[model samples]
Target: MEKLYDHLITHPLIYVARDAERALGFDLPVRGYYIITSGTSAHRKLAKQFPKNIFTVEAERNLDTHELLRHPQTKKYISDLKGAGIMVFKNTAMIEKTAKENHWKLLNPPARLVNRVEEKLEQVKWLREYADYLPPHEIAPLRNIMYEKKPFILQFNHAHSGQGTMLIKDRDTLDKLASAFPDREVRKTDYIAGPVFTSNNVILGEQALMGNLSYQITGLPPFTDLPFATIGNDFSLPHRLLTSTQLSQYKKMVTNIGHKLAGYGWKGLFGLDIAVSETTGRVHLIEINARQPASAIFESKLERDNKKRNVTGITCFEAHVAALMGIYIPNASLTPLSDGAQIVQRITKKRSAVADKVTEELGKLGLNIVTYENNAHNSELLRIQSKKYLMDDHEVLNNLGEKIKNLLD
Candidate 1:
């Protein structure tokens, strides 16, 4: 373990993001690491707690991580941390240039590969060998796609949190998009009706360290309005929801997919969204998140909490950084996280009266809350995390979820 830290500390590890609170479960030593983020309550708290380690890059809420990095203050800070290793939730060509200019290492896959695998149509071709596991999907020009008057999943080349993925139910909607982008090729598939599941997997040499499978909480009213917009993840439901055979099948699928990705010289974390057919109980690969998944920090936090009680294993975040640094944990695997859940509250109303009071009450109830200010419409404004289950078998909010939802509503 000491050797691991020794190697890791050789170059400073800097986590650059839109909000500093997102680094809650990074579990890296603060002495040799830095957090660069925009001004938020959580970011302010971290600045006070670790004055020397947190740098603020104040910007408007709509600016993303890449845009935030362009701030002169952000550049000045990076200039001081020359030769540092940069880590981010996602990678971009601009970010890669930042690293090169500062003589720092970009702790992520090359932007070219990330860009290639991110395309919805390219992912289908890349994983064609495992086509049996994918939903019936085809890529064609939007104008040429035949709509059968049924709800179908339509996807563009890139998007996040279902932003570019749409459920087209009418011919008029299809025609509108077709008229807008006639040359655009879209990935169309049968809308698989079921709860979506996602996992964060780390690719090591010849192996994929599979993390816990979580029930993807998405499109729940009061949380998000977009039908497929991701809300959060329920770590407590997967094992109970999946049969023994289904569990085995999922693991095999992910392992094989990761192995295939390894042949492409890919490393570190990549996530997969799998949808199980409600009618047939069949698992279908929905999409690939070719970079670190959004849920990694929260999930890694659970592993850290388990560590305090002597639970042993390399955590997903640990494995992620190690993989990026070209370090491998021999025979490393994580203990499956059996219980816990998290949800995000998208900003629907500006400065709602309930925001402050609810965050206070929820904190009193032992729930962890991270808030963001000035966020764009429908962007995550608050995130609630709990060690207990928040949803029931039918996917409805349990008592905990209800409590949070009621307070916010």
Candidate 2:
């Protein structure tokens, strides 16, 4: 990835930092070549990496300003960088506005397009019109009730990671659930009505670069035998879900959307969520995420092989470098890890005295344990807190708890 980035920097680069200092692990120094503007970051780390080839502007961290208005600090930074004719990466909504003010080129999804597509209702409408292959769903006001309807899913517009969602089976339960949270204004503010399913896609120019269907396997907690809901109510049995052929069909619709979005100057990574019905087998569009999905980190781990696929956390740094450089990457090949072999070996050594010896040896090489927790209970607490509020599936939480427990024990 560094090699690829080295090639891209020859054409000038823009670095938009959101918590840039922490993200890069250091401060940047200014000297020459390309223009770099700070968004959410306090300083430039690229300057540290390439001092002679980068210029920077520091942005303010004001939370009160309209996200589209450039804070005074950001405006000044943009002015300095633009005077030098350097491109800038604008991650924050305010900084994006600043870029437009100064005619600086930006690499991001267009805000209007993103705002439209990211809405749950709009996505469902768009998919129904364009794809015509989605499930039957009704988008009603949050306070509206569906008593005689079949089992259906509900979701909020701005929610992510499966928050603000529910599955309704009968009128009695739906009425009780609705009354439990009766502030119509609050419900409207928090969620929107829609179907639920997971979908992701990558596009470049007029082509679909990558697309795939994700299957979620869930289990019960240690004290229970019942499987918990993850994204939505789990169907009694697994269906074919979205097959590769269906993904191919959906690709055309996404390509069309991407093409239209490009008219607004969108050029980097984008993804969307999709839901399908079990009874009617209809597909329903959920919401679009204008930025990279959280799964992008894990997806970057997969690599193609000879007649098989593998998973490993290779090329993580490279992909980060590529995104920073604004390079279009089709695929990043990663090496697969051996099936628990290395982990087992390390565990065995840790059980013996050899673990201490290895730690001491590594310490001499400038490595040290930043932090460690040996108590299983404390470790479980940390794990639960990290995943709670973001996860609806108790099974996933339980599994994560077990993994942490195993590590501690």
Candidate 3:
């Protein structure tokens, strides 16, 4: 891993990416950019400031944007970077194939393992059998859950950021869902309300090197449609979102999952979502993200602001980069910084038309627009992101979200 790190300093880590610019705040000396989907106007302007190694190919939009790195256009982009180092991190068939074809060094977990973990059902099945903290859940074809009487959280077998999640309050929504997505696979889970939190862990072969926790922003009504659509994340003044036992339990759960993932050849950063029940105060597991999360960049930036050194003595960026490169990321103790919190706000495609206006208005209020897109049916649809500093007040962030929604409304 150190060899790759040293090489990347001069050779540059090639990124065949899509909306990957969101993670570039760390400045890892990455090069060979291939943004497959031309994102929103704000993001295109921001990404243009990307270092010289970037070569965007936004015209090719056939395959899903996440799968763009595997597209032929990416292959062509690599061919154009004739004399550069090839550092493949995203686990995709085209990426691995291209790397092997060029004899480039491969980072990230095995593509197969990544694909397996990305499935919502796979992790749910594992947790249902092994973990007792998650709410009672069931996975079946849409047909089976049609007559379910009690309210539950309805989700497609594969969807995120609120695209496939809903609160199944009654049969009417179910009827609508059946009519809309007759053939789609779905998961029905016990519904509980509380503060939703996200924890990020960097995993080696069988262990978590470090972890960070943040407040997950989801389903702020009017701004987003689904009851669980992800808007962004917040890390405000330090507070105990998790009890000592709950934190330990959460870490241990993540570590065990990490070990299991290691055995499956999975590596790099993984995230878990937990819903801290307002009633019982039990930290219940929701699901996992098998890749470096979009929120990591914001967390990393906050760490820099706190100026508190990680116990491992490695910066957030280094640990993440090293883990993917198959380098050892030593264990570290993390203390949640209490100075202030920052919010990463997202305006999804449903409200994409007002996205520019939102960012522009917020920019005047000291928040900077990060990135976004425009879409009707979510073709990397309009997603505008902005952040503001609060003295660790979750309410401040929530109020801001409400105000943003109202502005759009």
Candidate 4:
């Protein structure tokens, strides 16, 4: 582990973390940059890998505007980081206020853009100007059955996860549910409501960096399936939901939309959920995620390499270090971990015996463990807490799946 730290000290990297004070301990005097993250533990891990050169600003909590602006550390960190900082929060209002007051750079879409694109009705209006590329969708008025169609998806713009989304198969069911929750504001139907489509776009500024088509598997809900399968098998897919040509066209549309958004002060990452009709193959714009996608696919892709053990996690730290130093990442694809490298499951106290059992089993199969977390010694274990492995990709993943299945059984 010390060797790993020593290697990182010599390499250029970036650190992004929520707490800058706590992250400064792992500083390395190297030619790198950093961007302190605000919400997730994964970002914290990135910050821990490169300490000294990183800059971080804390997300102001639910305090009053005056109190948040006056916090000593908040004032200091924000004043220091200035344009290099990134802040994420659930409340759009607070995010807007804080960013304005402190002059911090937001890594997600601006609040105004989110508010504009969140409602299905507003999105429909925007898409109407480009009707040739979009599917027909009607915005239902408060508890009103605007469209006599089955299998429509109703979306609430401000909802997180899949909270404000509903799929209705028939008008009767829609009426029954709508009747049950009559308060229009609180109901899902009151928000930007629409039918679910197949295509989605992940945009950087106004350019579509990655575009994916959605498909339903046998066992999961239509929309929920993508997150589940993409989580572990990020490098593989059983079917093609969108062709290369369609994806290219989608990227153009996303770029146009993003350009329009830039006029509204949107200057970061955002996800646009678009729906394509199964029958007519027409696309419809759904809603936009103002922040990072909850699925964590971006981080997973960044950390997917296979050559170096635990490269995904380490590269994340390196990337953060680079971002903080105001270094421009010329190519993001080069930083991703290699394909087919199964993320070795982390060993905790509860999983110690299980990890040992699996380690012994794999050794018998002639698979040499490249990295293993030593839980016996406190300090060494803490240093290598999240252990990863380098293995024969096929054999290791299949064996890992088997091990998990056997343990569960």
lDDT of 1: 0.81
All candidates in order of lDDT, best leading: 1, 3, 4, 2
Q: Candidate 3 has which clashing residue pairs, if any?
A: 162-229, 236-392, 237-392, 372-383, 373-382, 373-383, 374-382
lDDT (0 to 1) per candidate: 0.81, 0.40, 0.59, 0.40
lDDT for each residue of candidate 4 in 242-347, tens digit (9 for 90 to 100) = 4465556666667676566555655434555554445555555545654443222323333433324544222333333233233344433223322222222323
Write candidate 2's Cα lDDT for 1-409 as tens digits.
3355456445434444332221221122322233333432223444565655443444344132233224465446545554432222224456566667767666555556665666556655444445443344566665674556665556555544434445556678767766775443222111213234333344444334333344322222331112222211121111234556555555565666666555556654566555444454444444566665433333332222211453432333234334434566654433332111000111121232223444344334332122121222111111111211112232232333344334334
Clashes in candidate 1: how many? Answer: 0
> Each model's RMSD to truth, in Å?
2.1, 10.7, 4.3, 10.2
Supply every candidate's count of residue pairs whose N, Cα or C atoms clash at under 3 angstroms: 0, 7, 7, 32
- Pairs that clash in candidate 2: 28-44, 134-282, 134-283, 135-282, 135-283, 156-191, 156-192
- Per-residue alpha-carbon lDDT of model 1 for 60-94, expressed as tens digits? 55356877777788778877877777888778888
lDDT of 3 by residue, 143-250 (tens): 667656787888776676667677888898898888877776787778877788776677654566556666776665454555676666655422445578767767
lDDT computed for candidate 4? 0.40
Ranking by TM-score: 1, 3, 4, 2
Return the TM-score for each candidate structure.
0.93, 0.52, 0.79, 0.53
Sliding window of 10 residues with minimal summed lDDT for model 3: 378-387
Measured by C-alpha RMSD in angstroms, how accurate is candidate 1? 2.1
Scored against the true structure, residue 153 in model 3 reaches a CA lDDT of 85
Name the candidate, 1 or 3, with the larger lDDT value: 1
